[model samples]
Target: MIDDSIRPQLGIIGGLGPLASADFYFKLTRITQAFRDNEHVPAVILSVPQLPDRTEAILAGHDGPLAPLKAAVSTLNALGVACVAMPCNTAHHWYDQLAANSRAEIIHIGDAVVAETRRSLERGRVAVLATQGTLVSGFYQDRMSAAGFELCLPANTEFQACVDSAISLVKAGSIVDAAVETERALDIAQATGADAALLGCTELSVVAASLNDVNGLLVIDSNAALARACLTRLGFGTQEARGLPTVSRPPGHDWPMRGSLAVLA
Candidate 1:
């Protein structure tokens, strides 16, 4: 029987991109309401930047990259975490396999966004700004379409290039340029008659909070959605999880990064 006195801890399989994982952690901290440190939800974060590139692995149809993620989930499960959340959107392509390999529940970030989008918007065009690999995988497309929402994407290769460039800029620590390119893509979405935009990439989510409204359309940040989902699943309320504090830059290495793993208890 599960111990009722011990609170459930969240396990994060991160480092698909270091910055995005850090951003998600920051959002998780700020979104929760806690007057003292112990009142906040406990989390175990495993950041493995050395894990093979998700996009490359997906395009190559190789299973090598999945090994590290599966291992991380296993480690978290061994630590007795109740649920696991992977901040990387592209990694969700292998969500089923990862979930199967672990004893703990894996929270699907894509599903969280799709649910939030459906609840927020009754029926209208939803723009998806994501990585090329994510777009090619059709992960969001399949889910959003089935949810009865019209999905709009970058119109051409040039627009797609802009989205890719923006993501790269964020990874390279050029947030200003990243925001500019992201805004350009949002403008394209607005021009295409999208009623809302979904920041489908975690890197894009890092910069999404700073973007101005495009033609008065709502912009959904996947990281925030995942954070709220984590809180709610842990029995926290979501009413105060509405907005995320501004993150000017990616978090430092104080938390685990690259090749190491740490359990925050």
Candidate 2:
């Protein structure tokens, strides 16, 4: 086990949708560089699904979710976490509101997703598949365009309805149904001549396993990206924590492994 006394603890301000929060934690644990159980991230998960609907609050310009959300952050901060992660993409519309008086640094979900998308495609149309609120707020468009990606919304209301259906199905514990809708959304995305697709909603990220690089569209998942960002910020990327070998491979040696690059050592 590694010494964690000096390491920062991670906090999650989740449950904008219960399933998405659970999936966010799953992604965070899955991608961590830990080799042992004790080496995993020390995190505080506050899953209060009762918080007011983020999408509704944003579209209506109401602050309904604000008070409870601040309380959730306060609860986590009081527990001594160094940084906070809110996996829900729609909730990020209130990101600045939440981060202003926060004791713990709030991690912005778009930064990680945009960074990953930028790395994948320097310039191209990236399908923005997310909640109506996120789209209405121009959240992904504003951030991704700065990274040189032209964020494309599926040209019709039906596309967003499909995505919304998919998100609802997942939240209702219907993964199979959600996968079907997710597939439909991808089909619409492909119609946009997109080079990549951004799974900007954490609920969509839950069924991200159902997505692949099929048809040459690079799928960027916001939940997974944010999870990775948490690991980096919390110091889990340290050489000692990852336990990478001191021996360097020969310069000409090929790294034969899966794309995820989860080191075997």
Candidate 3:
């Protein structure tokens, strides 16, 4: 049985790009479904927006991201957070090092997103829209494929541009533009004839509702999936009730769409 007094505190190592970090925290709160004020989960957010660009570091090799990541871990650990979660998909490539030096439990956002996608969707063609680093790492494709799903992707150049635009918009605080970039990514995924598009980036959730034109395509929002997972871990919402509040279904809704991270692998 879980001990209420010993509930673990959640630590967020954010600013992997600032917007994603904020979105993850917001979703975590919104999905908690706390019946009493004291039931709220404790969270420690370290938003160091100056950290090395995760995608840039991965593509360009270890050109100095270790320091910031390590610092993030240190800050959260000092704050007594028992588990840490990073919202960026690309950052997961360096997760081993981040976890190696910390006693805090680290949650793999990318893996969580993929696992939820598998459980919610039938094993079939899945396309992931993310930064070049994430694609290059084969993080989503490799993990999903290992689970018996055929992972599809956009044309090389198109995928790169999508990643670039999403990051650029999010950093600029142009959330509406971020949503547009997500739609563009979905288009690229559809062009590849994918059954669905996995929004492998956390920023997409910040403006997920702004995307209203994704007709006949399933869109998976990883950040939202993570929120649900966090809530489930805290015993807040049930399996079916653990996600974004329901609204009027947009037109032509055929597949599932959640704004939380889904555990993939």
lDDT values, one for every candidate: 0.79, 0.76, 0.71
Residue pair clashes in candidate 2: none
Q: Report each candidate's C-alpha RMSD, comma-separated, in the order given.
A: 9.5, 10.3, 7.2
Per-residue alpha-carbon lDDT of candidate 2 for residues 1-265, written as tens digits (9 for 90 to 100): 2245634388898787887888788777777766797888888788888888888888888989888888888887777789999998988888888898689999899998977676567798988888888888786888887887787776766678888998888888876567667666776677757778888899888777754334666888888889888888877852311221122224443223312222322
- Write candidate 1's Cα lDDT for 44-138 as tens digits: 78898898888888888887777788888888887789899999998888889998998888989888898777667888899898886787789
Q: Which of the two, 1 or 3, has more lDDT? A: 1
Which ranges of candidate 3 are over 4 A from the true structure? Answer: 1-8, 238-265
Q: How many residue pairs clash (N, CA or C atoms closer than 3 angstroms) in each of the candidate models, in the order given?
A: 0, 0, 18
* Candidate with the greatest lDDT versus the true structure: 1
**Leading candidate by TM-score:** 1
TM-score of each: 0.87, 0.84, 0.82
- Model 2 stretches with alpha carbons more than 4 Å out: 1-8, 238-265
lDDT of 3 by residue, 68-113 (tens): 8888888887777767888788778777889998998787776677
Between which residue pairs do clashes occur in model 1? Answer: none
Tally clashes: model 1: 0
For candidate 3, the C-alpha RMSD (Å) to the true structure equals 7.2
Better of 2 and 3 by TM-score: 2
